[model samples]
Target: MYYIENVDRKLFIYTIKDVYRLEASMQEIEKMTADTDLVRISRTCIINTDHLKEIKQVKNSRLEAVLDNGEMLIVSRKYLQDIKKVFRRDLS
Candidate 1:
């Protein structure tokens, strides 16, 4: 299960898949529920566009999503397009 660290405590978000293996893992559902503009970068992580403080481009066209919580997550190259699409969809 994934655990999101909120101001008061950590919230548990579970899944049947191995994606929830890490206690600090960030799930797409959690992000999506918090913000519709969030995108699934991989099987393990999701990012909230509304909460994105910065986006750094790295090697191989990969990206790093810096959240307002000061957490950084690497976005896989494979999901880059999907991420953009999700944000666009949220605008419409």
Candidate 2:
């Protein structure tokens, strides 16, 4: 499972089959899942690396993470270095 913050700043829990609002701040959720597969890819998104399908370079030198469910999430440059470390590959 993973969590994403919507435009309204409400947290939502995402599963392979469903997504439901989870009343928690991103910071709180991050802390709760710190030791798990979840990683912060962007200010609005936290994903389970275990569910990652691929990582690709996109325009503006940003990276895109493709999840197993076919959802593509942007990985901001701010977190690019961290992602490279996790994947053990050079993203540049």
Candidate 3:
């Protein structure tokens, strides 16, 4: 999966070319994928780091993840350190 997003209380899974509805909460999915490449980047988004191309800083202090498919997702302040540890790359 490329990413999972929760919008308006519903969850959708995005892949390279298609999207599917998933019948599970974010917490549950996170727990199940804890040992995998999937990592929660925001309250509404959990991304597959294996599909990540790069992450960069945008305006302000926000971090943005760019996927291999050329999609972008915001990395929130609350999960900055968590994401950094996963990639272990310099954020400067």
Number of the predicted model whose lDDT against the real structure is largest: 3
Q: Which ranges of candidate 2 are over 4 A from the true structure?
A: 84-92
Off by over 4 Å in 1: 1-35, 59-62
lDDT of 2 by residue, 1-92 (tens): 74464447878878867888888788897898665667788888888888889888986577888988888988877876655565563233
lDDT of 1 by residue, 1-92 (tens): 22233222333333224322234434435544544565666555555566767768876577787766676777677887876776778778
What shift in Å separates residue 18 of candidate 3 from its native position after superposition?
0.9
Model 1 clashing residue pairs (backbone) = none
Task: Give TM-scores for every candidate, taking all chains together and pairing residue i with residue i.
Answer: 0.52, 0.79, 0.86
Candidate-wise lDDT, in order? 0.57, 0.76, 0.87
Q: What is the TM-score of candidate 1?
A: 0.52
Off by over 4 Å in 3: 88-92
lDDT of 1: 0.57
By TM-score, the better pick of 2 and 3 is 3
Model 3 TM-score relative to the real fold: 0.86
